[model samples]
Target: MPRNVTTAVAGVVITVCAVAAGAGAAVPGKLGTRDGYEDAGGPVWYWPVWFPIFAVALAATGVFLATRPAVHRPAAAVAAVLAAQIAGRAVVGVRDWFNADGAGVVDMSQHELATVVTVAAGIALAGTVAACFAVALLWREPARGWAALRPRSLRLLVAGAVVAVGVPGVIALAGSDAIMLAGTVALTAALPWGGGLAAAAWLGPRARKVTVRTVLACAATTVLTFPVTMLYLMVSHGYDVTSLFS
Candidate 1:
């Protein structure tokens, strides 16, 4: 099969799966519930159908890991890490579900929260994939190019990812909780791309190796953010008042 055709198929699959997962997360017939609530409990983070949404996200993540880079070498390790992250997320997600009694009433506003998290996850995932494609599609020498990123560059990228994803969120929450949700979506989408660029800069190479180390690293970067964001949601108030649009 032609590489472009293969990549196109993979991209389409990623999009469809992501959309399905995200759509699964949305609660139906709840338009009026979109408003922000102060003192909303953490249970809102784990909606009733949370598993399906996460399952779709996991499936899409796997599909991408499988199809990315289009190299001859096996991607077993990358696949493994992707699986691990999803498994970890599932464990945490289920734990949250159980802790909330699984039958507990979902906050009317949870649909809003789910929307925020799902969008953010999608963005981070998509951006990292785009970065991988940028390396794979443009530079045949991904190994050499990715492997050459300096420490300073990697540090800068890490910092940039934090700021780009964080500052907007902080500002958004301060203005309106509704905008805080939007901030989550924006952060989830952009930060991993920045991280992927850094991964491409350092782990990325200009040539083939036993593995596309940079792509794997970039995927890991994307997946790792889930837990980090969850922790943030856990610690910080669910509502942000400083968001601009709120």
Candidate 2:
């Protein structure tokens, strides 16, 4: 990625971290049912929206660390984003700790929840970065053996293989109530880019690089993942699949 592009991406990370932290800092008391804000039947189910936020941020950080970017210098920008995430989480943790209802053990437990979640994210990022620093890194663009296949089959196999892994996130997001959204959305969204990149990179003699066509197939599969996720989540929830059309 270009330096400018890296900066923009870093800015996005910082912005998201800041916004989430700033929002959490606004809580005047420990979050729990004691405030009359929630109950056992609600969507919270022992996990709040922050769980997804942390999951996604950490996943992206790991992706960066595991795959060496085309340009190495911009890798440092990931650290800045990590810092912002930690700082923001710290603020939320402190805010929650002081404001928690000490007499209520249920509410008190959450004081460290923010801290623990961010710590996991930090470990994921830090560990990956350390590994990248130590090992012979891979470009993460093209998968091995896909391009070696005959030209005619490139579209069928190359795109099919990559798109198969990330189908559920697309579907889960469509589920009823608060929605089954998660930080894992990268799975489906990745098809259009990952498939296209793999197809473009396998420029060896046995095969020619195909662009938009491969992308279209990947895109179709990407669309398929969404409905699949929705169907699974709906059926699991006991929702009538046919009722959606009604």
For model 2, how does the per-residue alpha-carbon lDDT over 1-246 read when each residue is reduced to its tens digit?
Answer: 564455445434533443443343333232345335443231111222333343344345435543544433233333322333333334334333343335442342343445444543443344333323312221234455665444444564465445434454455556653122222333223432443335444343222233334345334544555566557545533457898898
Model 1 C-alpha lDDT versus the unseen true structure: 0.41
Model 2 TM = 0.26
Pairs that clash in candidate 2:
171-229, 171-230
Which candidate wins on TM-score?
1
Worst 10 residues of 2 by lDDT: 40-49
Kindly provide the TM-score of model 1 when superposed on the true structure, using C-alpha atoms.
0.32
